[model samples]
Target: MPRLIYDYTKSELERVSLSPDRFRRKLKKAVSNLLPYEMELLQKWLVFYTDNRPELRQCISELQSDHKGVC
Candidate 1:
């Protein structure tokens, strides 16, 4: 069983590991479909997964500051 959020699996997320830009796009897509409660888990998972990948972390940091919510 894989970690899922709105039909997206953890592996789907993992596949974009090398490209932080793509990861940001995919994560934004995932976040769009999540309910309010699920957002927290998504954030936590984002933190855990992006740890040690500063570029990805920077992408995440950028995502957080996106008020317009555009990917």
Candidate 2:
């Protein structure tokens, strides 16, 4: 699953989202400043991220299965 809405690359995602905390911080910053298209992209990213990475969703969700968003 991609932690970012836009996949610059696998390496980029890995570099940016190195830790859960870091990922959340980045995600919050991003959400605070989103382009219109990016908002749409984020919706897609959420679907993919959650679908492909349940543990990631769980971790960010603090083990709440129904919770959403990274930050």
Candidate 3:
């Protein structure tokens, strides 16, 4: 199953020793500071999904590998 948004966000913050609420507040402020066009681009990318599910899975796996190396 896909992870819930709250669970994913909470785990990510915990991995970096960040307070989830504080991080969210900061993110909200940062997003609010974006220009309208920038925000529109962000929304587009945020909602983009692959038509090929297998390719999406592979992309996510590759990202997870990269994340493991960095973190």
**lDDT digits (tens) for residues 1-71 of candidate 1:** 22355436356678987988788887777667676556666677778987888888987778778734332
> Can you write out model 3's per-residue Cα lDDT over 1-71, one digit (the tens) per residue?
22344345434433532343453443344344545555454334323522343433344344436445221
Selected candidate, larger lDDT, 1 vs 2:
1
Candidate topping lDDT: 1
Q: lDDT of all predictions, in order shown?
A: 0.70, 0.51, 0.39
lDDT tens digits, residue span 1-71, model 2: 23353554323334655476655555555555555566467656655765666545554455223334423
Model 2 bad stretches (over 4 Å): 1-14, 59-71
lDDT of 1 at 26: 76
Q: Cα RMSD to native, each candidate?
A: 3.7, 6.4, 15.2
| Residue 54 of model 1, lDDT score | 86
Clashing pairs in 2: none
